[model samples]
Target: MSSPSPKSPELSDHSKKYDRQIRLWGEHGQKSLERANICLINATAVGCEVIKNLILPGIGSFTIIDGNIVTEEDLGTNFYVEKEAIGASKSECCMRLLQELNPDVNGDYLDESIDSLLETRSEFFQSFDVVIASNIKEATLKNLSNLLWDYNIPLVYCRSLGFVGSIRLQFREHCVVEPHPDNKPLDLRIENPFTTLKEHLAVSEVNGKSPWVHVIHKHLVEWKKDHEGNPPKTYKEKNQFKEMIRIAMKSDEENHEEAIKAVNTVFESAGKISSNLSAIFNDEACQKLNTKDKNLQFWVIAKSMQDFIKTENNDLLPLQGVVPDMTADTDSYIKLQSIYRQKAMQDAENVYQRCLNTLLNIGMKNEIISENTVRLYCREASGLRFIRGTKIQSEYSDWDKSTTLAEGLECQQPLMELYAVLRAYDHFYTEFGYIPGESYVEPDTPKLKGLVTKLLQDWNIRHPVSDDMVYEICHYGGAEIHSISAFIGASAAQEVIKLLTQQYVPIDNTFLYSGITTETATYKF
Candidate 1:
């Protein structure tokens, strides 16, 4: 297709109500959600979070299947149930609150449990595109997993105890995941809630030591620089300063030199104010990322480069492909694409190398940077590639090898270098204090042109570029730290944009975790 179907008109209310979440998922994902018809088998706390997430993304319609009623305990965790709502049907109450979030949603509340529905209305789940079960028993979950599996519907099973949450995704027959080479038992150590909670509460901010406190100092210094007389006192003014830095980073479309300069000025000024302030932005924890693995590096650079693009532009766009109404001859098109395509690949490698070097300088081991265990993604983003003939038998194979551009590629180094520099500032500031060059911008289509410019060069690759090829990495839970969650979400979401937009080579079932260290390994199942 030359262009995506014209987007549905923006709903002002929805835009504001779901502002934060919409910023997370992007418009295309939101559109996928709008076209989605979902089913939730239960309405418990975890399920409620999932529903809230979906509703905020503007799901087209949903069937909430539950027979349970609200209880006093539910009121503590679920936002939907009020004191008056106790004893009312949980699904019904949830539906009402969801409506308040987005009236565009079509909701159906079932006051019957899954067992009852199975007995009387086996087809209850048939209409939904995806089904989520929360507030359900283990046996019920297994049973529903089987049912959803048989019916070819995607099912999400979630449970939470205090601070820890667990989610398992079960898909139907056609869906297959490459299993881990040495299939080990699923890690079932339910984290100790008290220990985790205690750890969170136990941490104290040392003047220049804590990340957030340093940010406070950075903002204060910036305020002092700009406003002259008195510095910020109220939480709101401090917040405004923080926001100003964020907005300044994303306001431009190219690079963020000014943003970088402003942050440095703030950091320098803070140093003069207090010894602790000087220690804040210079924390040892901050390390530049590595680019030897081109993919990782590209992500770092892409984030830094596109911060402004995402903030300034809102259109769903692509960097390369058949331009609308193009009349250039085939030869001319090929020649034009070759120039940009080569540049795209070159750019990817350059960014990757840059990020790699940065990480190494900050302390990441060179061995980890070069190991194939950590995929250096550096091609046009596309879908999770399944091997042409991988059978969906009971046993699964390593599917990562199959999920790539039909033609394999070699690593590009220069692009890696560029990626590292861009990422270093963000990592440095995040560890030290204050927002360095970071910006909060929603991902959009037009920003993708630069990467796709590379894909057009390799026309000989067997895989044809299409929307279905675009991939999205799924995240079910947050990391140990709250701030890390944003980083994780943004990283995963950016990959999805590349996957969907076919701006890079796709990674299949790529799992990225960094709680302890950056450990990346490809798994299928």
Candidate 2:
């Protein structure tokens, strides 16, 4: 008798709970999220909203740091605290409510002000994977930014006041393995096939009835014969090449039609390095591999890739091991896909060996990087990203030398104007111990405008902040609108997830949202 068929494994509780999100980021990314320890400063509406989203996604744990007691105003803006919770610790209230969202997520609170924490237990901040600061004062923000920069911890500084909000991401350097870009083209290697791929294509039966990839390969080979062994490089040449495929169509087959459609993009992108990937390869970090620092695993793998390209791979990134769907029989498609997969596996193995050799050359333990991790890096080599962040202190200290701000003012961009007003609002709060319009909008308009003028002058910007914008800022009176907080908070949470999982691309540095215009913009400092 045949052995009993093995039953398919069932989903674990953790996987079942986060099934939807696991689908989004995959189990690897979900595990990263589940292992993350997030630290949030302040339990303001925006801050709670940020944690609320994170809690639902099953982040391992979170610590809320806020010394303030909840007030009636807090009740209006924050949904996490109730009337009974008034006069209680804001951090505790937020933690209690947020923890209820996901039992799998562990949470705690520190009823201490940020300034106090920085003074006494600054090292405490270093323990977290990421820190989210909301509605913090400018001086406090600079201090926290500097502290975290030294610790090399990523900080998401966000604020939601009135109808405008902004988020600034501060990190020394961040590397992303899987950007999960949309509609990424297949890596067919048609233009520059490897030995295995070329061998397969040479032997595969080629006809209109076969897969489009095989058809394209057959035609590309013939096209290369008459064109000095080079695939069509010019626009006119490509078009001529497409016409050649069109003429070879037999009885208007769908595979031939698909082949014709792919002619434009297939050769253009095949065997070419994207500018973004090229930039990553040329980055200073990748150029200078510091073997002493065990944490520089991304750069280590990147250096291995560089070496692999030079020595074994012939100056090309590893095959992505993917093929796009095309008109073809199941058997033909599977056979072609297996060839690509086999080549991809071999390339990954080569790079993995190189990584191991690099690690040993530096007298480091090979266990510092796992073989599985190296394979992941090789799979995502083409989409690798590295971000070098600027400190918030630098942006404030070097306002005069900022050409991006100057250009934005000259162009009269609405978001840039809003950014100016927000800076002036911070100044007003610092000088007067309250926001401009907290008491009365009409009385604070000129005062706020004066601060805006001073800020513009400091930056050497000749542009003026419109009176209408100043009035709008004062009318909001530093009040945190719940809806706006939720919007910005959700957005910030998304950025935080990107940082934690290192999957999707996070914003370069700054994200600005205007509730009035219902628009958002990102800028690099």
Candidate 3:
């Protein structure tokens, strides 16, 4: 069959189907989503829910690893497994049902245990983009976490137990060029306009029809003349600057109003290097860009940007090529937009060349970092983020000595108490052959309390887990409620999407959700 052209109607329809999300993350992010291959460790209720959310968004494919068979309990808690699927392989049943959500998504399942896969065919996991594990034992989870951490693949470990759920993201390092932060101001560079922008503004007239950029530039030029060639630097001066704009308004012009509103932010540290970006540039990874590892692409680009800032760019980050909408004539708006767009393209091209030069010097392929990727990185350079994550196994091994946990408990946070109880539950399950509340809630309450007490003592924490909290957990009996599972499933899937697309910032390390109070918290351990 012949391939569809770029203007094909079929491609348009495909884009239209995901138009809403495409608007959020752009076409490149959508392509990343469609190219991802997710590995789900178990087909439990929460696990299937995570898969459902990812599949609906048209992920490339998924592989479910499970050795259990579907049972009556699964039908009650899990939405993917139907009643007729009883006695069938749980992973296979889930794969068949979930594939029905999006035919574009491919899926398969191994009716084998994850432990067996880890021991016998561990390399099979190398192909996946992200791994989601649910309802896994601590011992097995540690092995898997260690393995994936060594491989530098992100692992979304989550559990939905009764009314509470938690997710811990484990990875070696992750970098984001686009964090999609809200209320990012337009980088107009009015304070320090480039040659083209200065030429455009020099000829532009300030009137009711003028764009806000011109209006602000005109008033700013006048303000600088009267204030010793300086913009407003103090709070009172800024307010006075706004007053100047308000008093100079010939009428109730929208552009003038926008100028007054923009006075506070437009001149506030324009063309300054943010502390976060400065930190990124100074990071060891960015400093040591001579390595041959392809994973250092973000740092390599960052190093190139640093060099650009130091040499060619006059110590300023790349210009973000975007402008705000305001009341203006079509010609005026187009002219202003063109000036900024051209400057941005020039900056991006400069950065892209530096990246190519660095890659060649480091003995890597120049094509490893494409022009489009560099453009995207330069466009979102101000909002770039880098996260270095610790393994889940380390969290477990050092749980008792965690000062973050200690401080949360000292503050009498309910979620902290829940965290302790969950740890105790894990200890109970490992020591005994069953979950604490699996068969009997009343008899196991004391045992769970004892385990929590021992943990606190070992950690030397003075805060105590109350009896009521223990009873509450015992009452849950380790049962998986669909509502809680659904909530956690959606949250986990969102984090997975962030990881796959490398767009928005994922949680720093851990996220805890409590259905009882309808509140959530993020913790970095």
Best by lDDT: 3
In angstroms, the error of model 1 at 359 is 49
Which stretches in model 1 have alpha-carbon errors above 4 Å?
Answer: 1-28, 173-384, 387-525
**Candidate 2 local lDDT, residue 520:** 93
Which tens-of-lDDT digit does each residue in 1-525 have in candidate 3?
111224634558788889888888889889999999999999999999999999998999999999999999887899999998899899999999999999999999999999999999999999999999998888899999999987778999989999999998998888877888776756788877888999999998888888999988988899899999888889999899899888889866988888888887887656677777888988877888747454678888888888988998778778887887777877788788788888999999999999989888888888778888888888888878887888899877866446887899989888888888888888888888788788888899999999999988888787898898898888888789999999999999999999988888999888888899998999887
| TM-score of every candidate | 0.38, 0.95, 0.96
Cα deviation at 220, candidate 1, in Å, is 50
lDDT of 1 at 100: 83
- lDDT for model 3 comes to 0.87
The models' CA-based lDDT, in order, is 0.42, 0.85, 0.87
Compare candidates 2 and 3 on TM-score and give the better one: 3
Least lDDT summed over 10 consecutive residues: which range in candidate 2? Answer: 1-10
The residue-by-residue lDDT of candidate 1 on 1-525, one tens digit each, is 111244877778757776775665445445656787877777765566666666655678877777878898767666777788888888899888866876778887888888888767776777777776653543455566667666666565444422222333444322111111232221111111123222432342312222222233334545777766455445666456656656644333222222233332222222011232123213222123344432333334333223212342222111212112122334433443344344344434444455466555556544544322112222212111112112222211122332232322223222221122212222333343422212321231112222232333332333333321111100111112323333333343333333223233233332233333333333333
Between 1 and 2, whose lDDT is larger?
A: 2
Candidate 1 worst ten-residue window by lDDT? 468-477
| Sort by TM-score, top down from the best | 3, 2, 1
